[model samples]
Target: MSATTGAVLLYDGDCGFCTKSVAWLDQRNLLGFPARPWQSVPDHELPASPEALMTEVVLTRPGRRPLGGADAIAACVRESPSRLRFAGRLLALPGLRGLARAVYRLVARNRYRLPGSTAACRIERPG
Candidate 1:
């Protein structure tokens, strides 16, 4: 770990499940990357609306490119230990990418239904 420029994780602040997930990542020290609530990221800093962020997990790799949904998760894993990185690479295979994307979609779409999310978790766009 040579202090690589960490990725930025933009997530929904009001979703308890999302918060818990961020906490879990933090606990694992996987959140070396900046973790910003979707609402907090300045409009100019974000390439899209907050509503777009709410629809997916956006991981910005500063000066490079951003990853979203399953790709974001994979990128996070790749930035971790060697074993996890290998796993992430394995998932990038054609067939596996589809499966991973499908899984990510399922979790993302129903995140509000998971334990911890309340009606207050509705997505809000930044002006």
Candidate 2:
């Protein structure tokens, strides 16, 4: 696939939890797309503002709107090996989509407390 059509996963490099998660995906070869730390990605390649990016993972592909949070996770799964595609579809289903997003938000908000996470994983909440 062309670079524009290929999916790219952008995540927070400074967060230990985030780094570990990406490493897990890489170890399993479960991510079909290239993953990059948001800090290392040039501004022009980013689909959203830096502040927004810090709040959640983002999946970007040209000619389409960027997918954030749980949606990005679903998209990554769908792009993974055939065996895991079903789970990805399930996550994106209308009925489960909202729940998945909520869970993702919850986990994101408390990432600093999760295993492998460090103080840098603490996200600043907006007022």
Candidate 3:
């Protein structure tokens, strides 16, 4: 289907870790962004280049700017009904965004090497 109007949590289906993580979160149904593999997203409706797709988890909605990586996750938490909303706000704090991005990069970069990941899950870093 085309990218319809809804909060979609774009993930990498090829990544075992990513798939398992999304599955675990989907089971909980604790947030607004529902996870879907990037493979299902139409290329014309993507938020960024295809390369960036595998490098970050992205949150997208019709007629709105997409949020990526840690920010996307923080947005989900902020929109949640749980106490994690506090942490989500903190992630948007001045000094924390950089830290959060760094941590997200760490995980994204290592995801392929992590347990449950296959070689195809490795994202090629763009220059």
Poorest lDDT segment (10 consecutive residues) of candidate 3:
24-33
Predicted structure 3: lDDT: 0.80
Model 3 over residues 1-127: C-alpha lDDT tens digits?
A: 4556677878888888788767765565535667788888888877787788888889887878899998988787777777557788899997998999999889889998878788877877659
Score residue 75 of candidate 1 by CA lDDT: 70
Give the Cα lDDT of each candidate.
0.72, 0.85, 0.80
What is the per-residue lDDT of model 1 for residues 58-81, given as tens digits with 9 covering 90 to 100? 888757777788887767766764
Clashing pairs in 1: none
Better lDDT candidate (1, 3): 3
Q: In model 3, which regions exceed 4 Å deviation?
A: 28-30
Q: What lDDT does candidate 3 reach at residue 56?
A: 84
Please state the error at residue 121 of candidate 3 in Å: 1.7
Clashes of each: 0, 0, 0
lDDT for each residue of candidate 2 in 4-123, tens digit (9 for 90 to 100): 456788899899999899889777766767888888877776788888888899988878898999999888888888576777789999989999999999999999999999888998
Using lDDT, rank the candidates from best to worst: 2, 3, 1
TM-score ranking, best first: 2, 3, 1
